[model samples]
Target: MATLRLYHAPISTCSQKVRLGLAEKELEFESVTLDLLAGDQHAPAYRKLNPDGVVPTLVDGDTVLTESTLINEFLDEAYPEPKLSPDGARERHAMRLWTHLVDAQLHPACRVVTSAIAMRPAQQRLDREQVLSDFAKVPDPALREMRISVFEHGVESPYFERALRSYVDVLETLESALSSNQSDYLVGSRLSLADLALVPYVLRLDHLGYSHLWQNERRPHLTAWYERLHLRSAYDAAIRAWEVAPAVEGMHAAGSAVHSRVDEILGRA
Candidate 1:
């Protein structure tokens, strides 16, 4: 019952994740929109709130929470009516690991693709192929090898191509995780943070005009699961209500953790 405010950007998937989390809990909070495209987060006033200059700087009472995964976890635990995360320690850890992978690896690669593809003006395009070639630098040999076999699946190269690979990998893995012949949700056959984290990505896939790629013959189970989530009233309002221009292109839609968990998850020095 504390005063709550959210700093969000239309194009930010991370912010959207928090929005979905809050909505699922049925918590009513005020929303404040920030202009990420215009560099508003860099202003002196906002900098004091979040030095990182990110879209989702959540203000809960007097506490300011940055990071999408943390913020969403706080809402889940704080509200706790319709849980967004699971109960057991093992389930929680699994969810945390998946969230970290999506937030760290997939989201950044998606940004690289988006900035190169559509985030830039047509004439201003920075040559995505060159950008992708440059991506080979700070490289993880494992990701690079995965990136190659991924490209063989039939997608063009460049930054966005890597995004496509990551996207497909996520969807396929998720589909296989669902119950063999009967299940709707992602983890343990119930709605969890895993599903919520993924919904925004799926939403962006449609926004980017790649809806067909997720259709029947392509990823039937994944498509079905996404559609099922779309029917939830909370999902419809909290997550889908906002209008997004896509902070970047081809693949773009992208978290934080709770105060209590920070010391546990990140571990205090």
Candidate 2:
């Protein structure tokens, strides 16, 4: 087998999912970490691997994969010892639905929320004109414009409230699922691609000091499910080990500062 080479960014949610998948499979790979805030993804050389200029371009011999969800599915198919997917056809469909939701909805919401809360402070530290110049290079026009809006407006951006609501909806859905499911994992009795796909987003909220979304009696089932997953060694190796301390601290501070406002927006206040 040719060695796997992964081009990823440490703090990126997409990158985190792929890393978790690799860790679950116990596969070793050459890691090329990109500094996304520095526009490393925009470089011509990196763009060749991923035309979208996104983190997590996985290379396995001649097979190069782009989308993180697809990369994870490929990994499971290629190496299926302790399978990351479910056995039953219905369970498989359910798992795919979760991954699709992450790709189609949760991911966009996460980007906006992270930009509005965790990343805005760091972006502000850079020169304003340079920030605009860098964002202008983003391959997706809608994403580029959204980034500019979030950067300029932070939590005040119109996109922020909508994004935050998306998260609230996801949390409500998760709470309901966990409450109804027979297993601690999402789709079945064991960890599957579905749980791995959603964990990073949940972790992002926790990192941003938004654990109130699941903590306490508010969402007991979701809270317990998350705690159970957090105890796994793969979670520590893949996610916690890659966190940059300074960035985590900054996000916590920023999130804490806006807790009341976030609550207000969610009608919790």
Candidate 3:
């Protein structure tokens, strides 16, 4: 194994996914912790490695990889033993579809909702101006606006409602997927990249106080699927064991209100 180095933050879901991949492969690597709440990701030094200012940037020898799902694929391809990706083309496509759903839908919504309800309050306690300046450095214009809006108005911004809907849609999709399949994972019986891509999003949903969407009697398949994923040691080390901060505690409480609003909209209450 070429020297592997991962730059990540403690609570970042994308970082958690890559960590799960590495841990599952039993790969030894150096861990570089970035203070995301403190705006360390925007520092000049880190930007050279990943201009997007994202966590879980993987550096292997002279090669560098970004994007959590893509990074997981690269790791599996580079290290074949205990392969985390599937072999058959159809299965591979199925796995990629789940990853795509998460990267395209769940992740963006999770970002907006979590930042609005959970992260903004904590960040407000720090240097507000500096945080604004750091966020300005974000490469995507739309994302920059979303981040700023959540901070300025908290969950009252229209973006939060859209995000909440996206979260519900994702859970409903997961429930359907699990109901149609006999396998424990999103793609098949054996764990694959799809499961790795989704676990973090599900964890974020729970942390955001929205676990009731699938944890109840209505979505039994999703509930069982999550329980199966939880039993994995990699999930525990990468996600479950991390300590929650005071800001996140406040966010979780705030998120409960968001959940209630969503429940009313969906008529689940």
Candidate 4:
């Protein structure tokens, strides 16, 4: 077997996605944990492997893969038995579409909430200049600006409101999709890349104490889909362990304190 190594942070949603994919394939690999909160991801050595300096980088022999969705697809193709892609071209297209929605909509919104609620407060406790410097290290110019705004202003940042609204919209989309699909997984009756792509975001919703947004009597499909994900052993082995990280715990605690504010923003209050 070719050697496989993953560099990741425990609480990172992207990292969790990759981990779940690995676990589902019953793949054994070496783990290299990066302390994202401590600025480990921004180090020059790591940046060589991932120019964006993000977590959940998969290194298989000479090949280095970033981007959680792509990495998950790679894992699936590499180990086909518990296949993570659907059999037909149409189903595969749907799977890719779902993953695209996550990247295009859900992921950025999740980052805004995570930064505004959890990471911003944590950053405030650190050196201000260093925090700004860290924000500068983000490779994407637009994302860098958003991070800087949330870092400086926390909930008062304009992006927070946008993030809140975006999340609501995405949840509505997910609820409708799940209700209409009549499948436990996102794209088909079986678990596929689309399901793995989204599971981490669902876990993030729960961790952020925002589960009630879609866990109500009216959103049975969304609730049921989430529950089905948890029933998988890979969910616990690959994803759940990270939920208890000290940084993640701190974020969750911070998220709990802002429950009323978020509800008000979403008009759930």
Give me the candidate number with maximum lDDT.
Answer: 2
Q: Tell me model 1's lDDT, rounded to 2 decimals.
A: 0.65
Ranking by TM-score: 2, 4, 3, 1
Off by over 4 Å in 3: 244-250, 257-259, 262-269
Off by over 4 Å in 4: none
In candidate 4, how many Å is residue 268 off? 2.5
For each candidate, give its TM-score against the true structure.
0.74, 0.98, 0.93, 0.96
Report the C-alpha lDDT of model 3 over 1-269, residue by residue, as the tens digit: 58999999877889988988988888878889998877788889999999999897999999999999999999898987788877789999999999898889889989987888778867888898988988888999999999999999877787988887888888889889889998888885689988888878877777777777777697999889888888988777777655467645775777776666667656676
Q: Pick the candidate with the highest TM-score.
A: 2
Off by over 4 Å in 2: none
C-alpha RMSD between model 1 and the true structure: 11.3
Query: In lDDT terms, how accurate is model 3?
Result: 0.84
Provide the overall lDDT of each model, using Cα atoms, as 2-decimal numbers.
0.65, 0.92, 0.84, 0.86
Q: What is the lDDT of residue 127 in candidate 2?
A: 86
RMSD of each: 11.3, 0.9, 1.8, 1.3
15 in model 4: Cα distance from truth in Å? 0.6
lDDT of 2 at 248: 88
Give the per-residue lDDT of model 2 (tens digit) for 116-197: 9878888889988988988988989999999999998999999999999998799999999999998989998889999999
